[model samples]
Target: MNTMTLWHISGWGFAALAFAALLVGFSKTAVSGANTVSLAIFAAVLPARASTGVLLPVLIAGDVLAVLTYRRHAHWPTLWRLFPAVAAGVVVGTLFLVWADDGVVRTSIGAILLLMAGVTLWRRRRAESADGADEPDAVTSRAGRMKARSYGVLGGFTTMVANAGGPVMSMYLLSAGFRKLGFLGTSAFFFLIVNVSKVPFSAGLGLIDGRSLLLDAALAVFVVPGALFGKWAVNRINQRLFEQLVIAATVVGGVQLLLR
Candidate 1:
């Protein structure tokens, strides 16, 4: 499709896409897993393959805001440890996309998101039960190099295929005992780097185009307000509430994708 084609979307379609864009920004800064809603919305509004392209620029815009807001809090060592594995996973995902049609891609992503959401909830429950009512604000790092790499690979694969990396990374960060700021900061940096990395791959696959760029430009305006709101909200929220919201959004978004 050409640039003019995207401009023909109805007012309601634009409204939904704009809302999804807002969610993208909010998720980046406040609730990390919440962007899964944006992913599902984009898919619903556009073709599955085309939606990924349209959403990439918006995600990167959110990532930029997240980095600017949380750059100082990032943990570089952990990010460094995960990079190699993430690269491998991205390559594998790109190869998979080569043969997979939209139906295959959509169904596979839905199933994976559902499974990951279940795992995240299960882990959270176990952690809460084990730690008791007075759980520490910070979790001790249980992520060895192997485990980190595993999460990294899954994160890369999911992000590449469906922009569903947030939940995967959220689980990993939570497991490693990252609290609110640390989780946001580290995630902000990780996605900034990784999402930018996907640009060439996306272009090579013809996933991004002038039409998507036109839509993205319109959607980008809402990101700033959403991000500011998220920045404000994140500071006031307690840890348990934050985790619960993220898990709920992930599960709900996963189910939406499955049913779609």
Candidate 2:
């Protein structure tokens, strides 16, 4: 591969990537489902397929920070229940990647982002309507099992395809009545394991290589500060306002990709 392929990014493009990398860390530590914006920015700045590869390592870095901060709060049983279905979905997603070209992937990612945003808004409205009637854990009952399996597979596929699985998993956790700390903790561990697992598949697909890794190295520095800032702000931040911002940014990014 020509070195220029990696280094061809302009200073402004690099700045954008650096900002996206920071958001990756911030999303991991503070807002569980906010990184869809990062995903959109990355895809816009780089080739769609290559963007996923370059973003994976940075996500892992953020995941590590999140896990360290919230490791104790993770719900193990939920993770166990979801893993098999998620693995199956990952395999299907790999097959899809084998078939898709860059343009198709880009369009698919844009669609997925928009769909996830819609789902999140719907879930939130439902949650508000239900109020105090928090549903029981979705990993125990037969209906819950089916629900987990459905979400697990969808989460796996979305994450594998576009690094857009956060919203799916967030919906699952919220529906299952995860408190804030538990949600963050479970999400932190789930993504760390899943994103790390994706490395070999991405490598096999040639999405990750020397050039992508080189770009990752350069962008990674920004993740640490972002994570630290998120950690500092997580408790103080206004949840409603932040979520609104996340949703708005996601819509814009999704529209841009679809139109592009």
Candidate 3:
């Protein structure tokens, strides 16, 4: 209960961590806001700085699993195109992390998430109206390019500060017209590369350390089951509905991050 005790570890807290990991798994595979919930939970259980470090490895673990599950489904062209801009955004976010107030950071992240969620919802709605039980032209292009530069930049900035990169990328893929597995797979790989790349940056920021890594090692156990379950759930659910779930969760999580 004391601050010192929290700093070490909490057994029931691991349970809390596992529950959050389950959310992370779901978010990684189904929704984009899972990180927001996991981030808040980890921050509550550990120090904010410590929590970010601790959660990063576990996320990478989940990212690996998701990438494996959906590896073949990624839209590589979109991913490749987004890389430079995303990297640029990451630098911007890392810089922002250096001096911004936590409240300001959360609010900005929340606002972006909320806005992306809204856009995704509207697009999906239109996609459904345009056609159903069949893939639309919008979601099926290989060289589809419009907002790649803009989305990539925003996605990078969001992910860096609040680990909010998932939704940013989610909206990008959604607008580009990727299917569920493709979206999940592309997101999986993109974050894998991006999140892994962040280790050094995060380290420089002192957002990662020994205690946090140990905790990540311990909590990584929960993500597999969550991913498996999400995989199954997505298979049976209607694609539109499944994405709506993710978008709705995004709005809630986004708002929470901003309001918190």
- Residue 227 lDDT, candidate 2, scale 0-100: 94
Q: Which candidate leads in TM-score?
A: 2
Per-prediction count of colliding residue pairs?
0, 0, 2
Spell out the clash pairs found in candidate 2: none
lDDT of 1 by residue, 19-59 (tens): 99998898898878777778877777776766777888999
Better of 1 and 3 by lDDT: 1
Instruction: Name the weakest run of 10 consecutive residues (lDDT summed) in model 1.
Output: 131-140
Clashing pairs in 1: none
Candidate 2: segments with Cα more than 4 A from true spot: 1-7, 130-138
Task: List candidate 1 stretches off by more than 4 Å.
Answer: 1-8, 126-143, 238-253
Error of 3 at 190 (Å): 1.0
Please list all clashing residue pairs in model 3, or write none if there are none: 139-177, 159-165
The Cα error of candidate 3 at residue 125, in Å, is 3.0
lDDT of 2 by residue, 13-124 (tens): 9999999999988999998878899999999988887788888999999999999999998999999999999999899999999999888999999999999999889878
Candidates in order, TM-scores: namely 0.87, 0.95, 0.80
